[model samples]
Target: MMSRPLATALRDATLLGAALLDVFVHVTSDEPLRMAVALAAASLLLLRRRLPLLTFLLTLPSVLLSDAIFASLAALYTLATITRRRTLLAVCAMAYTLSDMTRWTPSPHLDLWNPSALITLGYTAATAAAPVFLGQLVQARRDLSLRLTEISQARDHERRLSAQAVLAEERAQLAREMHDVVSHQVSLIAVRAGALQVATQDAEAKQAAATIRRLSVQTLNELRHMVNVLRGSHNRPTELTPQPSLTDLRRLIDTSGIDTELTTDLPGDLPPTLQRAVYRTIQEALTNVRKHAPGATADVRACFEGDTVRVTISNTAPTRPALPLPSAHYGLIALHQRAALLGGTVTCGPTPDGGYRLRLELPVKQEP
Candidate 1:
């Protein structure tokens, strides 16, 4: 492709060459002064783009003094392409009217009122209009193309924003579902477990009931945490509430409504975020058991091994038929994401004994 400067130089050269050729072809006299003036006028066409009005003014003398028609036409075309339409029209009208008065000749004895003189004037007007019309047409096409490009870019931007808005709305809907359905059901499970634990006499039955209630309370805390996060700047009352920590795990396990045990040897001082992740991991594991293995016995263990905290919750197969409950399939996935964000990992799957096991491993400290 031609560089801009090279292309412009080539265009100016072509216009200058055309003007000189026209002057040479139309020269009615071989006078040296007329030839020199015509050549000067043609040379001025090279500067037309940079100084179009000045070039046109310089070429006007050649048009009036000699028959350098093409030189004047080139200058007028350059001006028409660069200047406004009204300006070009006014200049063209004035220049040609002067030319007709000074240089146009119909016949030796004919006056301005003669039909031949009117024809000559009309021909000169047409000659001036031709290049101006072409310049305006080219400018109009360029403007239209630029406007189309702007409109296309604006449409693409609108589409991107619309997609973002849709994603935000979907996230808000998911938050609503978690709050309305999951939190409400988990709270009921906790309440039922608490009542059963208080009313039971068997050591194993009481232990299981306590575990259910404990886990339910933990789930409620975590749910509140997530709700606050989703609410953003809504300025709700829950925004300032404290989040759950590892210290709450014992209380959490004591509320589960199934036979469950918790053994933990965690540090007293852990990062608040990591504590929350650990609590949520255990809460979600118990919630899964409550949903899928209603009468199953479960074991939960947490310990600091080297530089990491590991928690494992395992439940035996359900002792009764599982309840039919609607599931969004998001609980464990959400738990996995929370662990990952804290630079931890979670694994949950069926065990060889036809049971479920959820394991979480997190760093002892918050990742930088």
Candidate 2:
């Protein structure tokens, strides 16, 4: 039945309603035709729910003229469910007004004050209002879904950014550690080579010279490793060698010059990242002292207080600045940044006792 054109069923019922009311009103009293008209009206009524406005117009003439006013009620229901609320309301109101005005012509007078009339008016208003309400409900749900999706996407992006930041920091810390490990060893080699240069009085010194050369080569290899650590260019994860911790500062002291006084309460076996930072801080401070305080005695102190590893380097200040400062001592600036990244700090200045004082402190770990 759905395959048939909707318009056909509506026309049949309208014609039938008109014929039934006409005969009843003494307009056409053919008994056989009246029965057929009533059947056609039933057909249009059934299909009216599928196409409200069309069925209403088709059945309107007969309903308005005779006892068939009841036909419009079903059509109004369909309009409320399927069409826009404004259109449904306007159509229903107009149908009511036209049907009522026909009372001036020989039609049945509709008493607006009657309960039946009020019921019909209420039904029409509900039909129009329902569509607007449902549309609003559906729209609200869609907006909520969109907001949830946006929040989810933002959270995922935030996680990714945090992971990248952590990875970058780890790479930098590894670099600083490798540089300290390699630099300390290199300074020792240079010092030993100077001593060997003075003690040799025979050809046997040639062996000592060779040993020094070997040490220099070992130091060069460490420098290369330090560079690779900073660049972090390895594709394989295992290619990145692990570094020593702050516990290894004893190695640093062993190679260091006279007047070295080590005092550290720093955490033992600290997080690799924080330990690497502390190692670099000491390396830079000592390097600066050796270069700037030539012929002047100094003392080195490293202390661990709670969450921080503090390194202080103090040396008698010279009347003149060091002859060579190696490009404004970029090492000190690098050390400052390393400590800051770890949530620590660094300070370098002239001591009240006329000595250079350097101190650095950095955090133990990233915040959870």
Candidate with top lDDT is 1
lDDT of 1 at 219: 74
In candidate 1, what are the lDDT values of residues 134-191, reduced to their tens digit? 7777778888999999999999999988986776677577779889998999999999
RMSD (Cα, Å) for all candidates, in order, is: 7.9, 16.5
Instruction: Provide TM-scores for the models.
Output: 0.54, 0.42
Q: Mind giving the per-residue lDDT tens digits that candidate 2 earns over 211-256? A: 6656576566767675675556433333544576877787776555
Clashing pairs in 2: 13-40, 13-41, 266-304
Off by over 4 Å in 1: 1-9, 23-36, 85-88, 104-111, 153-172, 190-368
lDDT, candidates in the order shown: 0.81, 0.64
